[model samples]
Target: MSESTGGTGEGTRAVRAGLPEPVKNEPTLPGPVFAAHFHLPGDVEGPYTYGRDENPTWTLLERAVSELEAPGRDDVQTL
Candidate 1:
């Protein structure tokens, strides 16, 4: 356990910490999302524009890595 990883060991933090909470009948890890563009009816500006740029899956991974690097802290930006 390490302070940087919220008291979880490096392996556990690398594998599970900051990941989306598991639900019954759902996989522990989310699968990759495949799409070029989503239906944008109203606003043209948003976090997701194209798959090449960013998506929800990537967002989760980013947050997980950030937490592993600096657990229990919000001031640091990992992305």
Candidate 2:
């Protein structure tokens, strides 16, 4: 595909995308965030206010899977 869309190869993009940037003395991959409930201390105006609704970890995984399924494309919907 194009370099702008997902850089070089499928294997490279699949493993690199949807992951946190490398940091000094930090794990390459981050741990999962699990929570059945969250403290709504203020106005609920963020992407994550409930666990059941969505999870950051899951979102990243979904993106990675989508890229693997269809590279250089945006018409992807996961159930």
Candidate 3:
């Protein structure tokens, strides 16, 4: 067990750092409002075939959290 945030070096990083800012998706401090889906051009297929598949906000949060957990997050599983 680490005297700091867990013995894992990755865990230490997670504890010290925060999330990454949204790059292309960035909004004002207000941030991008939630959109269930983006309209695709005719026959464009899709950026997201379905809303259930993925969302921008979800991705932002996931990326941020992923970094915090870093090496520790090798194989995250949700039961």
Model 3 CA lDDT for position 32: 64
Which prediction has the highest TM-score against the true structure?
Answer: 1
Error of 2 at 52 (Å): 2.8
lDDT of candidate 2 over 19-62, digit per residue (tens): 65689999888776765565655755766755666778778877
TM-score each candidate: 0.62, 0.56, 0.38
Please list the C-alpha lDDT of all candidates, in the order they appear. 0.71, 0.68, 0.51
Task: List where candidate 1 sits over 4 angstroms from the true fold.
Answer: 1-7, 37-47
lDDT of 1 by residue, 1-79 (tens): 4433335577777788568777999998777776576665787786686666678876777788787788767566667
TM-score result, candidate 2:
0.56
Q: List clashing residue pairs in candidate 1.
A: none
Write model 3 residue lDDT over 1-79, tens digit each, in one string. 3443445465555543334433685752335645554564675564544466576556545655665555445354221
lDDT for model 3: 0.51
Give the lDDT of residue 14 in candidate 1. Answer: 76
